[model samples]
Target chain A: MALNRKVGFFKGLKYKGGGPMWAWILHRLSGLAMVFFVGSHIIAGFLTQQFGSDVGIAINIVYENWIFQLVLFFLVIFHAVNGLRVTLLDLWPALLEYQRESIWLEWLVIIPLYVLILFTVLKSALGL
Target chain B: MQKITLKLFRYNPETDTKPHYDTFELEAEPTDRVLDLMEKVKGYHDGSLSFRRSCAHGVCGSCAMRINGQNMLACKTLVQDLKTSRITVEPILGLSVLKDMIVDMDPFFDSYKKVMPFFVNDEPKPAQERHQSIEDRERFDDTTKCILCGACTTSCPSFWSNDEYIGPAAIVNAHRFIFDSRDKGAAERLQILNDQFGVYRCRTIFNCTVACPREIQITQAIGEVKKAIATGSLD
Candidate 1:
């Protein structure tokens, strides 16, 4: 049988679930955000170092902005901590039986780090 | 006995352009199954309504559907377990529905066959039966409980998004033979499973594990296969 497009990408979200599905969705989105952010950051660095300064200047203005930095901070921390939880679960499949427990643990690890990063970025951004 | 309103999904692709739910009011004992509820509606209320069941004891895997927003064996789920005045019955997701409640399972079986779900032993026959250690049997024992029910596969998130991803059930079926000490078919099966649409496509959503009627630790089985293939170790 062919693919049923009626069951679209948000099929999982359509169902009420515990923490794992939401964690998976967030992990994917955060990972994607990191990929775009790093790709641009690397591209901007190379451009500034080699070609004209126009691309670099534009990227620097965005990078120096506190909102951009805070977004980057959120994305990086979320991706890393969730990635660690996923990796640990992968390495030990037995841990997956505790999917609910691990998700809370991932959040516990993520939130405090996220808050600390947020405050630091806020301090730096506000210049206070 | 209690009066329950069963809101069931109704669709005939040949006649209707879209799927819709048909509600049936029926009397049922608290101990009666969801399948029994459907039977009351079909026998007394309507005949054109469609569904499938055989053993009615849950072994046949024929009556698997979403009952009360969960993938479960209709015959295996009692009315009281749902605890709702209105029982919402729907076909399993990510599969084409053929009629009122039955889903087309041909594509689901196609993926099962892709795993070469039989023993492949080209070796010379021994005088005795093929031997397997207790430990080796224990390794893949969890996967052997699969009844070929589409519950786990239909419930998989990867199968929902990408229909070609070989789903969790097939991977679990493959895991049955991959770790069998007597079987010499791991390499060939691993090739198909290692494809881009293979086992790697599973994002560990764990829906299959939750939906499985046999209570197979499906995600763990999938992980064991992935770990085995990557390290070239069959432990």
Candidate 2:
């Protein structure tokens, strides 16, 4: 039965999907962030070669900022850890039933590592 | 008994320009099932309120709808389990909604059909019946629990994006037979699942796994199907 009452895009996002859903959304966002970062990195390199070294240096200053590094670190670490969780579940279907627990475990690995990353980044940023 | 506000997503093609929520405040026990609340609404409040329910238990899968925010069988989901007095009921996401809490399941079933859900054994029928080792039977045991509820499929992001993606329920069904030791149709089913709109479309998002009222490990089953496609071995 064809009906015009399809789920609107934003409405679909509002569903009470649990942790796995959030994981998926974050994974997608982190992946896109990585892609954007890589593209910008390449563009910065190109600008340095074509325009001048000053343009690249300016971009590097922004990138090397502590806030930017923390955000980038978060995106990279979350993406990798979540991707690993997905891969592990994919490889072992038996763990599928523990999908929720796996997400928690993913966070277990992410939290301390992220804290350490934060400590390192902040220490370096502050020249401590 | 607590008075709870039940908000249902209602749509009528003939009467309404767009879908709207109809809220009914009802006295209900926390122990009462969402289906019981729906029954009260249909019985006392609105006769025209449309939904599908059969085997009031979870077996039929007819009562599957979005309860609060998660896809669940209303009969199986008690109000106490929700922990919130304000309950929001809507049709499962992704599929075209036909009316109040009912969606066009044809597309869902069409995907199911593409998976060749039935057993295909070209081999002659055995003397008594085709025998299967316990381990062989156990290989597909999880997927066999699927009640063909569109819950898993409709909840899937891939299925939401593209209906032709042959959603998780179908893959679970395909996995049912693909791993069957007695079934001779794994090759054909695998070929069907290897299409562009097939196993590769799955992004390993566990929405299907969570949405499954039958508690089938849907993402795992899809992963198994993908692995089967990759390895070319059902073993």
Q: After superposing candidate 2 on the true structure, give the runs of residues whose Cα lies further than 4 Å from its correct spot.
A: A1-8, A53-58
lDDT per residue (tens digit) for residues B1-235 in model 1: 8999999888877788777888988888999999998888888888878999999997988988888767899999998988887899888887877787877888789999999999998999999998888987888888899987788888777788778889998999999999888899999998889889998998887778888899998988888888877888786
**Model 1 reaches what TM-score against the true structure?**
0.85
lDDT of 2 by residue, A56-128 (tens): 8688788878999899999999999999988888887667778888888999999999999999998988988
lDDT of each: 0.84, 0.87
DockQ of the candidate models in sequence = 0.33, 0.57
The interface root-mean-square deviations, each candidate in sequence, come to: 3.1, 2.5
TM-score of chain B of each: 0.97, 0.98
Top candidate, metric TM-score? 2
Displacement of residue B231 (Cα, Å) in model 1 is 1.7
Checking candidate 1 for backbone clashes, the offending pairs are: none
Cα-based lDDT at residue B128, candidate 1: 95
